[model samples]
Target: MLSKIRKNLRAFSFPLWIVAASFIGTIFLVWGKGSVSGPSGNEVATVNGEGITLTEFNREYQNTVTSLKKKLGDNFRKFVKEDDIKKITLNRLITRKLLLQLAEEEGLKVSDWAVAKYIEEIPAFQENGKFSLELYKKFLESRRMTPQTFEDMVREDLLIQKVLTAVNRAPSVSQFEIKELYRKVFGKRNFKYKLFLSKDFKPQVSQKEIEEFYKNNREIFKKGERESYYVLKFPKTKEGEERARKAYKLAKEGKFKELMEMKPQPLKDKELIEKVKEKGFSFRSQENGLELAFKLKEEQYKSLNEVRGEIERALREQKALEMAKKEAETFKGELNEETGKVDVSELVKKLKLLPTTNPEELLNAKVGKKLILPVEGGFAVLVPTTEPEVNEFEEDKLKRLKEFVLNVKRDSDYQNLLNLLRQKATIKVNQSLFRSVQ
Candidate 1:
């Protein structure tokens, strides 16, 4: 869990889109004559003349990498192109710069102390439910962060959150809409579902059905190839990191105080921290560093490499379990006898899987793979169903469908707004810089 939460960011994170706001304008960037100049010549643009320096850009880019590593996991660095991450990061920064500038224009002022307080409140930097000076110091030491740098991140997070909250001031749905949503989302139906295993139909499936299904649902069938993944993680809450750094410092300074007096951080999980310590894993003042945990001959603490093999084994076992569940109610259908042995067209229509010209009965399909088979059960290969057959669109379902359509329209409108922002802003990217990074 610590590994997962620390610095993880995936492709699904904030997309490069502009949010609609009655508010407009960028924040006035506070950089003197010696402002950080962005790598690109075109540094000052929309907001209060904030210069995007190479240093600042690099910082953002590194942050992007850190976040992606957190989300996609440690392996993300190997799989994701650094250039791609930079472009995405740069665009996001610019959009944010514009939004923040607008927020400034609207007279939104966040205090430095507020930022500090917010940072103090973060649970990750806490130990024993209180903000620890040791925790803060350790984080700065390990990640090479200064109090100012940490404060800036907190401020920016709060600033963006404030801006977004303001934009969505009237967060609401109508009573009728809420009722309809509740019914559609939470309501359970008693309608019986019949299984039509595609394997049974596979015997009679023809080339025509195969070709047609392939033509229609080919996109779904095509899978993106996997890439090598690389990940680097910053230890959780600086506790583990602090433990390492303190020992390293002591080793260098020759300060040996096992019962070192240190206060915990605000909002930290004290109970959990105590539990970890109770497990014969007390922080050794100047011991063998992280080696203390890994070097133990007993099973209490396994080396990271040792733990990974077990993790992989567990994953494989989980996959086996899922495959078993999917095969139990499987069905297959086909059109061997044309006239009416089974109405080839009707069977295809009922099953909803697009029929291919030729069908192969796949007994086992891994979760990642999509398969079309006609077995003795019931389902036959046909066009993937968008909605139930003409006879099957139930009463409440129609209403739900209408709402879904509206939501799609709203999403489309949001995208259009983002495109407009992109146009209005002067965004210049240092592609060469990014290319090298990638």
Candidate 2:
């Protein structure tokens, strides 16, 4: 219950710090920066005249990495490229700076009293439904934040909210539109269908067609370029790196392992092969840094015979899909117009309708009509059994629907506002400085 309240408070553009002995109550405080320094040192970007320092950029970058790591697990770094992450993080920082600049220009101010009130209202910061000064101090200490620093962050967040709220007005919805929407969404749909598996109609692809496909898409058969290196693992410490560098220097003399008090291990052929197949894995080991002296190998493409099977499979799927469409066309005239129905159980495999497979197309279908739509590994032929009927509405559902629509409008407006500010602001980004962010 306390967590629920804490989450709600955090959504109000204010950070609430709560102190417990364990790592239970936590607050994600938005860090605020001072006035931008001149373009002399490592400034990754500048919004208007305010420069984003390397220190600030690194902090945000690390925070982004942590969040992504949590969300994607081990695949975070694997799927997302370093340069891509840097670009996204830099854009976000610039957008934030632009928003803050706009807030100041619009004369939006947040008082210390408001900030204090917001903090006190957080259930996590309260004891017996009242604010606790001791808990506040402990929380600040735990986060290594001074009271003034926390207050300044809260002030900036509130100012940004003020600017956003000023332009974000709730959209009005009419009764007729609401009723129509409710009918479209909550209406009962009864559809009977016959699913056709693509694999069942696998067309025999000729050898000549396979050759053509392989010729046109030659890059698919080409192997990824690889680098083979004997990695000498060492602990990440000052002494360890020094020793590893000495070993690297001795590599020229062919006494690399002898000098380093180690045996030369053979480069794992199987491991290198696996790395070539999987694009996600990085073979370079940064800890020892000995992999730098190794040789790089050019990639070799597979022979035509090696990739013939793959091309044949792709061709078969293409032909099968075309055949499925033709098969669906044949069933079109089977419908009896006067009765508005046909018993297709004997002719085709009958199945129930599922929302996952083209719900919109199936729901809005005309009676006694056939819709041949693509499904996973197959095609489905749908026939609506009955006309769509509106379900009874509830007051709570109507209220929620209105709020959802209004929120969508406000979100769109916010994005447009950001784009306008980005175009108008004198923003400059130094690509070289991005490399220095640790």
Give the candidate number with the greatest TM-score: 2
What's the TM for model 2?
Answer: 0.57
lDDT at position 25, candidate 1: 23
Model 1, residue 403: C-alpha shift (Å): 14
Best by lDDT: 2
Alpha carbon lDDT at 203, candidate 1: 30
Tens-digit per-residue lDDT, 1-438, candidate 1: 212211221111332222433222222222212223234553422223465556566766776777778879989968777556765565666666755664455455567767667667767789889988888888889877788887775666555545454433212346456444443333322211234442322133344544554455445443353211111122445576766666445434533233132222222345534543344233333332232211111113333344444444444444443443354335343323221222223444444534442322221122223343343333322222121113233558656655665566544443343454455554544445545543
Model 2 lDDT tens row, 101-212: 8767755567778888977886778999899998889989987779987777667666666555544542356877776666555565566666666777958999999999
Question: Which regions of candidate 2 are displaced past 4 Å?
Answer: 1-38, 122-135, 138-144, 189-322, 329-332, 336-356, 363-370, 375-378, 382-387
Clashes of each: 71, 0
Lowest-sum lDDT 10-residue window in model 2? 20-29
